[model samples]
Target: MTAREPRLLVVDDQALVRSGIVGLLEAAGLEVMGEASDGFEAIEQARRLRPEVVLMDIRMPGLDGIEATARLMAMPEPPRVLVLTTFDLDEYVYRALQVGASGFLLKDAPPDRLVDAVRTVARGEALLAPALTRRLIERYLAAPAPGVLAAPATELTPREREVWQLIAEGLSNHEIGARLYLSEATVKAHLTRLFVKLDVRDRVQAVVVAYESGLVRPGAQRATH
Candidate 1:
């Protein structure tokens, strides 16, 4: 049997851009459940349509994407958010991640990459590239946002901490398993425990907590395979 395509809500202030994104995703055989021009509308549509993934634009006239993302995440059954921005290193993208966005994509990303990102987030995986992840975190860590306190890393066990470190280094669960000589199932089990200890909702949030808590510094050397 064929897998079901992810249902999507495309949110952009610009009509042209929103339409283009909708067309691209629809053409790729994904379902476009609805579209919204701003954050407030996005939230309403999300509540009603209940898409599996949301392609959210970073800027809007009144309610911006970052704030919208936070509101959407606050929902009882929030859809996975894949942020879209014109700039690769935008601080707004980091803010979105802070509020539980699943991942982000450059607006100019290749069509295939964009489609793949939707599927990735839909499957509950983050889509941050290793090098770009490092740069984005390093740039934002200089002045951490208020009320965004660091998670207490002391709560994690030694094994969980090692898994967390690999996650921060942008390793997939499978890759982490291979690197540590553990099974993928074991890696997922570790992730589940660590996520609870860290009070993070997902891997993206876990990575954020790792950097914020100084458990994983922005420029720290990553483990080699």
Candidate 2:
């Protein structure tokens, strides 16, 4: 049987940008559930259509992407959010990640990359990969944000702390398991416990916690214990 196409919700305040993205995605053979011009509408459409992924624009009129992402994540079964922004260093992108976005894509990225990003998030993999995301965090969110834990590094067990650092270093679960000489299943178990202890919704937020709490610092060598 053929696999189902990923269902997507395109949310952007600009009509042209939204139209362009939806056209490209549809051309790429993905299913477009609906489109919304603002965050509030994004939320309403998302709840009603239950798309698998949301292509969210950071700057919207009623509610911004960050706030809208937070609300979407709070739903019983939330769609993965992939933020889009003109600039990679846009501060709002960092906030959206903290609020549970799966990853982000540059607004000007080639159409192929945009389609790939949606598929990647739909498959439940992080779109930003840790290294690139680490740089963004280091550059923009190194200082404490209102919602992140700045001093909670001490709360983690030695192993959990190690996992967090590896995650911040952009290591995948399989890579982390190989690095630590543990099985991938064990790594996922640690990740689950890590998420609960850190109060993060996903790996992106967990990485945020790692940096915000000073568990990992940019440019520092990652050491294996």
Candidate 3:
């Protein structure tokens, strides 16, 4: 049987941009479940529609995407959020990821890339590129926010810690498995346990936890097991 297309909620303050995005996704054969003009409506629509993914804009007039992403994550069953931004290194993008955004995309990204991003996040995977992930996290950490503390990773087993480090280094499950001489299924199993231990919902959050908690330092050489 064929898999079902992911239902999406497109949220942007600009009507033209929102329409264009909706058109692109629909053309790509994805379901456009709803659209919202601002963060408030995004939250309401998400609650009512319960789409599988949300394509969010960062600088909406009210509430804004970061807070909206946070609120959505607090729901019992939150939709995966792929934040849209004009700049790849936008600080708001980092903040969104911290608040449970599944990933981010550049507004001017190719249509195919955008579609892939939505699908990737909808499938419960983060869409951040490895290089971009490191750069963004490193830049954000330079002026780290006050009062935001990393959750301790002491509860994670040694093997799980190894997996977590690989993830922070931007390795995919397949790559991580190859690097650690484990199967992909085994890698996923470790990730599942890691998420529970760290109280993060997805890979992006896990990466944030790794950096914020200082379990993996940016620019430091990866430790060999």
Candidate 4:
């Protein structure tokens, strides 16, 4: 394994939850930098610790995960947020993505799921399996407001557009490469170009831009996989 294990911050109101998550991550050879009890504290800890990923809870006394996510994202080098909460319903997922959460996972996610989510978020990718709920995307599009994306025109190519659509729909790079009849390396290359063109740092940002900029819509008919 690479020596560069990701640093993680666990944020939840419950002490047991934070402790358990920290144990699991540390066992997986990742660093657990700190833990926070609520969104406000999560923000404070993140500002000080600057971990690579945050395991966030959606609801808390002072600040909710969504609000915390927005605050974290405002930082110049914000950590990737992996929301671990029950707010996976449509509205929350939409808003979470809008505010730049890297992925959503249930608090009850299996051990492997939690590990996978952390790894995915650390690598700047979104997960297909939402941590919070299954119907979140559907709920989000019921009354859609155009999302704000930082991407500009004259950046992405047409093939990159296709890739972006798939990416927003939560396909991994290998899957996208297969769908596009390109190798994973080729897909990564395309993604690199897309990232540079879009001025985004990672896959989460790419997906957000794709959806908010109207490149892909949750209401659209699903394409054949």
**Candidate models: Cα lDDT each:** 0.88, 0.86, 0.89, 0.76
Name the lDDT of candidate 3: 0.89
TM-score of each: 0.92, 0.85, 0.93, 0.82
Please name the candidate that would achieve the greatest lDDT relative to the true structure: 3
From the highest lDDT down, the ranking of the candidates is: 3, 1, 2, 4
Each prediction's RMSD over C-alphas, in Å, is 2.9, 3.5, 3.0, 3.4
Query: Of the pair 1 and 2, which is ahead by lDDT?
Result: 1
Q: Candidate 4's residue-wise lDDT over 1-225, tens digit each?
A: 754878889998989878998888888778899999999999999999999999988777889888999999999999998888654464665677668887777777788878888887788776645212224554554433555344473466889878877876767778898888999988999888988888776776676566557666656664444
Clashing pairs for predicted structure model 2, backbone only: none
Model 3, 1-225: lDDT tens digits are 987889999999999999999999999999999999989999999999999999999998979999999999999999999999988788899999988998898999999999988888988998888778888888887634444445558777889999998999888888899898999999999999999989988998898888888777777775333
TM-score pick, better of 2 and 3: 3
Superposed by TM-score, candidate 1 places the C-alpha of residue 49 at a distance from the truth, in angstroms, of 0.9
Q: What is the C-alpha lDDT profile of model 1 across 1-225, one tens digit per residue?
A: 988999999999999999999999999999999999999999999999999999999989899999999999899999999999999898888889889898899989999999999999999888787777777888987634433445567777889889998998888888999889999999999999988888887888888887787777666688544
Cα lDDT tens digits for candidate 2, 76-135: 999999999998787788888888999999999999999999998998777885656867
Least accurate stretch of 10 residues (summed lDDT) in model 2? Answer: 144-153
Please estimate how well model 2 matches the true structure, expressed as its whole-model Cα lDDT. Answer: 0.86
The parts of candidate 3 lying over 4 Å away from their true place are: 142-152, 222-225
What pairs collide in candidate 3? Answer: none
